[model samples]
Target: MARQSGRHFSGPRLSPEQAARQGRISQLAIARLGAREAIAFLNGNDEKLGGRPLDLAIESIEGLRAAEQRLDEWAEA
Candidate 1:
């Protein structure tokens, strides 16, 4: 852990792109899945994604699109 002003940092900070991905995915999930399902979907592992949707989405543009596609599929069902 890094220390600054006697405070210890817990983990690496999110970059701007990662932050953007998180915001986008969260909004989409909440809008399509509602609050409860959105939380579960983001935090839970997805068989189709092969990882937690939120983590995949923040990893890259392709992952974000994949997560969005899954969200759409769930919303339509």
Candidate 2:
């Protein structure tokens, strides 16, 4: 018998608006921090986020709003 792959297939789902916002945030990240740094920033755990994953933060409505606010602040700084 063939062994089944253990990897989960489903990924985090987002609404259209949420996705658009995510894209905007990503663009801001790229512009402010450079592409590589922005990617790392999104993938890395954040101190200000109480040690939560940034990926998780950008997945939900509230989380995305918070992330945008934080990113906006970062841009201004």
Candidate 3:
């Protein structure tokens, strides 16, 4: 017996407005810090930083929540 992959796909494409909204969301997700700073911090290259995965994970979650809130506000406007 062969296993079948079940998948359902839909949608033609995102409209220009939708694409712009997505771009805004992406920007909001990283608004808290510079990309380079975040990369260095996550890799434990920053001074006063110990290699703590848990702390980094928590920070990432917080950042996501903030970005979600911003997106919500944008949607309401």
Candidate 4:
């Protein structure tokens, strides 16, 4: 955060591409896991990824790929 005009302002928001990536992960999760389970899966920490799936998905393309792969793996199992 930064102060401007004696008011605090937050950091930059996600870019359009980042928002799109987040949507991709969310939609995929909802498709495979259903709404309730998808919410849990995204929020829950994964042993393989070593982080929350949603966080990873939002971070980068590579992390998004890993998250999607994990979801597929979960659905398969």
Candidate 5:
């Protein structure tokens, strides 16, 4: 679906823990940004994330934390 939608994802294969974190971030985005916007945000590059999105978080735990932090800050605002 993402490829069909022209979204590009480049990162490492996700571990179970990383996948769980991704799911949590998605849920947070859904709650704060709404479903459609959350999907777009997840698929889009974020400046706060160093021009990376949640998809790139799979490459490293630090990347996942950065993504989570961005979402957390967004939720607080």
Candidate 6:
């Protein structure tokens, strides 16, 4: 099986250790999304001659959306 980060299995059921690890991983994932959103929001405020910053922000939002989709799929599984 593909091993998930910060996860460990023990016996027939998920132990407290595994649950705690999963919790930490979930927290980190949430934090990452929050950071990405913040970056995108801040990037949106940039006003420059060229559209480079806007382009970058759009790319970042796309990447973040993809990542969120993947995470949702993983959670469903």
Give TM-scores for every candidate, taking all chains together and pairing residue i with residue i: 0.85, 0.59, 0.30, 0.81, 0.62, 0.28
TM-score result, candidate 4: 0.81
Candidate 1 lDDT tens digits, 1-77: 98558778899899999999999999999988899999998999999999999999999999999999988887787
- On lDDT, the stronger of 4 and 5 is 4
Model 6: per-residue lDDT, tens digit, 1-77? Answer: 89679967685664565454444434544565465643453344333312233233234544434434444543454
Task: Write model 5 residue lDDT over 1-77, tens digit each, in one string.
Answer: 35466667886576798787688778878998899878887888887677655775665677777887787776677
Instruction: Look at candidate 5 and tell me the lDDT of residue 29.
Output: 81
Candidate 6, poorest ten consecutive residues by summed lDDT: 48-57
C-alpha lDDT of residue 14 in model 4:
92
Candidate models: Cα lDDT each: 0.93, 0.70, 0.44, 0.93, 0.75, 0.43
Pitting candidate 3 against candidate 6, the one with the higher TM-score is: 3
Off by over 4 Å in 5: 1-13, 73-77
For candidate 4, which ten residues in a row score worst on lDDT?
Answer: 3-12
**What is the clash count of model 6?**
0
Q: Rank the candidates by TM-score, best first.
A: 1, 4, 5, 2, 3, 6
Higher-lDDT candidate of 4 and 6: 4
- Candidate 4 or 3, higher TM-score: 4
Question: Once superposed on the true structure, which residue ranges of model 4 sit more than 4 Å away at CA?
Answer: 1-12
Tell how far residue 77 is off in model 1, in angstroms: 2.4
